[model samples]
Target: MRSFFRGVFVIFFLMTASNWASASIGCGDFLRDIASPPDTIEFVGCESEPTKQGAPLTALYRVKGKDALAAELYLDKKMGVTERMKFVCCVWEVRGETFYKDKKTGLGYHIRMGSEETIHNKREEWSKIGYFYITVVHLREPL
Candidate 1:
Protein backbone atom coordinates (compact mmCIF):
# COMPACT_ATOMS: atom_id res chain seq x y z
CA MET A 1 0.00 0.00 0.00
CA ARG A 2 2.78 2.44 0.90
CA SER A 3 4.67 1.75 -2.30
CA PHE A 4 1.53 2.10 -4.35
CA PHE A 5 0.72 5.46 -2.76
CA ARG A 6 4.26 6.68 -3.20
CA GLY A 7 4.23 5.74 -6.85
CA VAL A 8 0.93 7.51 -7.35
CA PHE A 9 2.20 10.68 -5.69
CA VAL A 10 5.35 10.70 -7.78
CA ILE A 11 3.37 10.30 -10.98
CA PHE A 12 0.97 13.04 -10.01
CA PHE A 13 3.80 15.43 -9.16
CA LEU A 14 5.59 14.70 -12.38
CA MET A 15 2.46 15.22 -14.43
CA THR A 16 1.65 18.50 -12.76
CA ALA A 17 5.18 19.81 -13.06
CA SER A 18 5.39 18.71 -16.65
CA ASN A 19 2.21 20.56 -17.52
CA TRP A 20 3.38 23.76 -15.86
CA ALA A 21 6.80 23.61 -17.46
CA SER A 22 5.29 22.98 -20.87
CA ALA A 23 2.96 25.95 -20.63
CA SER A 24 5.66 28.39 -19.60
CA ILE A 25 8.28 27.02 -21.97
CA GLY A 26 5.84 27.05 -24.86
CA CYS A 27 4.97 30.66 -24.16
CA GLY A 28 8.63 31.57 -23.95
CA ASP A 29 9.28 29.97 -27.32
CA PHE A 30 6.31 31.78 -28.79
CA LEU A 31 7.52 35.10 -27.47
CA ARG A 32 11.02 34.51 -28.71
CA ASP A 33 9.86 33.58 -32.18
CA ILE A 34 7.21 36.23 -32.60
CA ALA A 35 8.66 39.18 -30.70
CA SER A 36 10.67 41.66 -32.74
CA PRO A 37 14.41 42.19 -32.41
CA PRO A 38 14.43 45.17 -30.09
CA ASP A 39 11.36 43.78 -28.29
CA THR A 40 9.66 47.16 -28.55
CA ILE A 41 6.13 45.86 -29.05
CA GLU A 42 2.89 47.79 -28.50
CA PHE A 43 -0.34 46.95 -26.81
CA VAL A 44 -3.15 48.08 -29.15
CA GLY A 45 -5.86 47.63 -26.50
CA CYS A 46 -9.40 46.35 -27.04
CA GLU A 47 -11.84 46.56 -29.94
CA SER A 48 -15.54 46.00 -29.42
CA GLU A 49 -17.82 44.29 -31.89
CA PRO A 50 -20.96 42.21 -32.09
CA THR A 51 -20.52 38.49 -31.69
CA LYS A 52 -22.36 35.71 -33.49
CA GLN A 53 -24.40 35.33 -30.29
CA GLY A 54 -25.41 38.96 -30.73
CA ALA A 55 -23.76 40.04 -27.53
CA PRO A 56 -21.18 42.75 -27.16
CA LEU A 57 -17.71 41.35 -27.75
CA THR A 58 -14.36 42.97 -27.14
CA ALA A 59 -10.80 42.01 -28.11
CA LEU A 60 -7.62 43.35 -26.57
CA TYR A 61 -3.99 42.72 -27.31
CA ARG A 62 -0.32 43.58 -27.59
CA VAL A 63 1.00 43.98 -31.13
CA LYS A 64 4.37 44.42 -32.76
CA GLY A 65 6.09 44.84 -36.13
CA LYS A 66 4.47 45.85 -39.43
CA ASP A 67 1.99 44.03 -41.67
CA ALA A 68 4.07 41.03 -42.72
CA LEU A 69 5.94 40.76 -39.44
CA ALA A 70 3.30 42.31 -37.25
CA ALA A 71 1.49 40.44 -34.51
CA GLU A 72 -1.96 41.03 -32.95
CA LEU A 73 -3.89 39.29 -30.20
CA TYR A 74 -7.29 39.38 -28.45
CA LEU A 75 -7.92 39.81 -24.73
CA ASP A 76 -9.85 37.12 -22.94
CA LYS A 77 -10.97 36.32 -19.37
CA LYS A 78 -8.64 33.41 -18.82
CA MET A 79 -5.86 35.95 -19.10
CA GLY A 80 -7.96 37.91 -16.61
CA VAL A 81 -11.05 39.29 -18.35
CA THR A 82 -13.80 40.34 -15.96
CA GLU A 83 -17.63 39.86 -16.46
CA ARG A 84 -17.58 36.06 -16.26
CA MET A 85 -20.73 35.38 -18.32
CA LYS A 86 -20.00 35.47 -22.04
CA PHE A 87 -18.06 33.66 -24.74
CA VAL A 88 -14.78 35.01 -26.13
CA CYS A 89 -12.63 34.28 -29.18
CA CYS A 90 -9.40 35.57 -30.72
CA VAL A 91 -7.83 36.29 -34.14
CA TRP A 92 -4.28 37.07 -35.18
CA GLU A 93 -2.45 38.59 -38.16
CA VAL A 94 1.29 38.47 -38.76
CA ARG A 95 3.46 39.44 -41.69
CA GLY A 96 4.57 36.41 -43.75
CA GLU A 97 2.75 34.10 -41.38
CA THR A 98 -0.71 32.63 -41.87
CA PHE A 99 -3.39 32.73 -39.20
CA TYR A 100 -2.65 29.08 -38.48
CA LYS A 101 0.73 30.02 -37.00
CA ASP A 102 -1.25 32.12 -34.57
CA LYS A 103 -2.72 28.86 -33.34
CA LYS A 104 0.74 27.65 -32.35
CA THR A 105 1.01 28.57 -28.65
CA GLY A 106 0.24 31.40 -26.23
CA LEU A 107 -1.35 33.31 -29.06
CA GLY A 108 -4.88 33.22 -27.64
CA TYR A 109 -6.93 32.23 -24.63
CA HIS A 110 -10.68 31.55 -24.20
CA ILE A 111 -13.37 31.00 -21.59
CA ARG A 112 -16.83 29.42 -21.67
CA MET A 113 -19.69 30.77 -19.60
CA GLY A 114 -22.72 28.93 -18.19
CA SER A 115 -23.74 25.31 -18.51
CA GLU A 116 -23.40 23.43 -21.79
CA GLU A 117 -27.14 23.04 -22.19
CA THR A 118 -27.85 26.66 -21.42
CA ILE A 119 -25.16 27.94 -23.75
CA HIS A 120 -26.26 25.60 -26.52
CA ASN A 121 -29.86 26.73 -26.34
CA LYS A 122 -29.30 29.26 -29.08
CA ARG A 123 -26.65 29.90 -31.67
CA GLU A 124 -26.45 33.48 -30.53
CA GLU A 125 -26.48 32.70 -26.84
CA TRP A 126 -23.67 34.56 -25.09
CA SER A 127 -23.74 32.17 -22.16
CA LYS A 128 -21.75 29.52 -23.98
CA ILE A 129 -18.86 31.86 -24.65
CA GLY A 130 -16.21 33.35 -22.40
CA TYR A 131 -16.72 36.75 -20.87
CA PHE A 132 -13.70 37.84 -22.85
CA TYR A 133 -10.51 36.67 -24.56
CA ILE A 134 -6.93 37.95 -24.67
CA THR A 135 -4.61 38.12 -27.67
CA VAL A 136 -0.83 38.52 -27.86
CA VAL A 137 1.50 39.01 -30.80
CA HIS A 138 5.26 38.92 -31.08
CA LEU A 139 7.39 40.39 -33.85
CA ARG A 140 10.74 38.75 -34.24
CA GLU A 141 13.17 38.07 -37.07
CA PRO A 142 14.24 34.63 -38.27
CA LEU A 143 16.34 32.83 -35.67
Candidate 2:
Protein backbone atom coordinates (compact mmCIF):
# COMPACT_ATOMS: atom_id res chain seq x y z
CA MET A 1 0.00 0.00 0.00
CA ARG A 2 2.78 2.43 0.82
CA SER A 3 4.45 1.75 -2.50
CA PHE A 4 1.19 2.35 -4.34
CA PHE A 5 0.70 5.70 -2.58
CA ARG A 6 4.22 6.80 -3.46
CA GLY A 7 3.63 5.95 -7.06
CA VAL A 8 0.47 8.05 -7.08
CA PHE A 9 2.32 10.95 -5.56
CA VAL A 10 5.02 10.79 -8.20
CA ILE A 11 2.45 10.71 -10.97
CA PHE A 12 0.62 13.74 -9.56
CA PHE A 13 3.81 15.75 -9.29
CA LEU A 14 4.85 14.91 -12.81
CA MET A 15 1.47 16.02 -14.18
CA THR A 16 1.62 19.38 -12.41
CA ALA A 17 5.31 20.17 -12.80
CA SER A 18 4.76 21.91 -16.09
CA ASN A 19 2.28 24.28 -14.44
CA TRP A 20 4.93 25.17 -11.89
CA ALA A 21 7.41 25.96 -14.62
CA SER A 22 4.95 28.39 -16.25
CA ALA A 23 3.85 29.87 -12.94
CA SER A 24 4.53 33.57 -12.37
CA ILE A 25 7.41 34.35 -10.07
CA GLY A 26 7.56 37.07 -7.45
CA CYS A 27 9.59 39.85 -9.04
CA GLY A 28 11.28 42.92 -7.61
CA ASP A 29 12.88 46.26 -8.51
CA PHE A 30 13.78 46.24 -12.20
CA LEU A 31 16.27 48.70 -13.67
CA ARG A 32 17.23 49.89 -10.19
CA ASP A 33 20.77 50.66 -11.35
CA ILE A 34 19.98 53.23 -13.96
CA ALA A 35 20.84 56.91 -13.30
CA SER A 36 18.64 58.70 -15.79
CA PRO A 37 15.19 58.63 -17.42
CA PRO A 38 14.76 57.28 -21.03
CA ASP A 39 18.36 56.07 -20.78
CA THR A 40 19.81 52.57 -20.93
CA ILE A 41 18.44 49.85 -18.65
CA GLU A 42 19.89 47.07 -16.53
CA PHE A 43 17.09 44.53 -16.60
CA VAL A 44 15.87 43.51 -13.16
CA GLY A 45 13.36 40.88 -12.07
CA CYS A 46 9.70 41.87 -11.71
CA GLU A 47 6.42 39.93 -12.07
CA SER A 48 2.82 40.27 -10.85
CA GLU A 49 0.66 37.45 -9.52
CA PRO A 50 -2.94 37.13 -10.56
CA THR A 51 -5.36 38.02 -7.77
CA LYS A 52 -7.68 35.32 -9.07
CA GLN A 53 -7.79 32.59 -11.64
CA GLY A 54 -7.36 33.89 -15.19
CA ALA A 55 -6.58 37.38 -13.94
CA PRO A 56 -4.34 39.58 -16.03
CA LEU A 57 -0.72 40.00 -14.96
CA THR A 58 0.90 43.41 -14.52
CA ALA A 59 4.58 44.38 -14.29
CA LEU A 60 6.53 47.55 -13.71
CA TYR A 61 10.20 48.56 -14.01
CA ARG A 62 11.93 51.63 -12.69
CA VAL A 63 15.05 52.97 -10.95
CA LYS A 64 15.22 55.53 -8.17
CA GLY A 65 17.93 58.15 -8.78
CA LYS A 66 18.41 61.65 -10.10
CA ASP A 67 16.68 61.93 -13.46
CA ALA A 68 14.90 58.72 -12.48
CA LEU A 69 13.34 56.46 -15.10
CA ALA A 70 10.15 54.37 -15.02
CA ALA A 71 8.00 52.22 -17.31
CA GLU A 72 4.82 50.13 -16.88
CA LEU A 73 3.83 46.94 -18.70
CA TYR A 74 0.79 44.69 -18.45
CA LEU A 75 -0.91 41.77 -20.25
CA ASP A 76 -4.58 42.09 -21.14
CA LYS A 77 -7.11 42.49 -23.94
CA LYS A 78 -6.46 44.89 -26.76
CA MET A 79 -8.27 48.22 -27.07
CA GLY A 80 -10.13 46.93 -30.10
CA VAL A 81 -13.38 44.97 -29.87
CA THR A 82 -13.36 41.36 -28.66
CA GLU A 83 -16.33 38.95 -28.61
CA ARG A 84 -15.59 37.91 -25.04
CA MET A 85 -15.64 41.52 -23.84
CA LYS A 86 -18.82 42.81 -25.39
CA PHE A 87 -20.56 43.45 -22.05
CA VAL A 88 -17.62 44.33 -19.80
CA CYS A 89 -16.67 47.91 -19.17
CA CYS A 90 -13.72 49.77 -17.71
CA VAL A 91 -12.32 53.27 -18.05
CA TRP A 92 -8.74 52.10 -18.36
CA GLU A 93 -7.39 51.33 -21.79
CA VAL A 94 -4.81 48.65 -22.62
CA ARG A 95 -2.96 48.20 -25.85
CA GLY A 96 -0.30 45.59 -26.56
CA GLU A 97 2.75 45.96 -28.74
CA THR A 98 2.42 42.33 -29.80
CA PHE A 99 0.19 39.24 -29.48
CA TYR A 100 0.94 36.00 -27.61
CA LYS A 101 -0.72 32.70 -26.72
CA ASP A 102 -0.22 30.31 -23.81
CA LYS A 103 0.73 26.76 -24.64
CA LYS A 104 -0.98 25.26 -21.61
CA THR A 105 -4.32 27.08 -21.79
CA GLY A 106 -4.25 28.06 -25.44
CA LEU A 107 -5.44 31.51 -24.33
CA GLY A 108 -4.43 34.54 -26.36
CA TYR A 109 -3.35 37.84 -24.84
CA HIS A 110 -2.07 41.19 -25.94
CA ILE A 111 1.35 42.01 -24.56
CA ARG A 112 3.16 45.28 -24.00
CA MET A 113 6.82 45.32 -24.88
CA GLY A 114 9.18 47.67 -23.05
CA SER A 115 12.89 48.15 -23.49
CA GLU A 116 15.97 49.05 -21.52
CA GLU A 117 19.20 50.48 -22.78
CA THR A 118 22.65 48.98 -22.38
CA ILE A 119 24.33 50.13 -19.16
CA HIS A 120 26.75 52.73 -20.42
CA ASN A 121 27.62 56.19 -19.17
CA LYS A 122 28.49 57.27 -22.67
CA ARG A 123 25.44 58.37 -24.67
CA GLU A 124 26.66 56.86 -27.93
CA GLU A 125 27.32 53.44 -26.39
CA TRP A 126 23.71 53.13 -25.11
CA SER A 127 21.40 50.56 -26.71
CA LYS A 128 17.95 49.30 -25.75
CA ILE A 129 16.97 45.72 -24.84
CA GLY A 130 13.31 44.66 -25.11
CA TYR A 131 11.05 43.09 -22.47
CA PHE A 132 7.69 41.35 -22.98
CA TYR A 133 4.71 40.45 -20.74
CA ILE A 134 1.32 38.63 -21.00
CA THR A 135 -1.57 37.71 -18.62
CA VAL A 136 -5.16 36.48 -18.90
CA VAL A 137 -8.33 38.52 -18.41
CA HIS A 138 -12.05 37.61 -18.52
CA LEU A 139 -14.52 40.40 -18.12
CA ARG A 140 -17.67 39.74 -16.12
CA GLU A 141 -21.22 40.84 -16.66
CA PRO A 142 -22.00 44.21 -15.06
CA LEU A 143 -23.82 44.09 -11.76
lDDT of 2 by residue, 1-143 (tens): 22222222232222222222233323333222111214432343434434533332333433222212222311122222221101112111123233334454433333232223223333222123223111222111111
Residues 48-130 of candidate 1 have per-residue lDDT tens digits of 32232211122233322121121122212112323322221221111121121233553332221122122232334332332
| Highest TM-score model number | 2
- The backbone clash count of each candidate, in order, is 25, 2
TM-score of 1: 0.18
The 10-residue segment with the lowest total lDDT in model 2: 83-92
lDDT of each: 0.25, 0.26
Q: Each model's TM-score, in the order given?
A: 0.18, 0.23
Q: Highest lDDT: which candidate?
A: 2
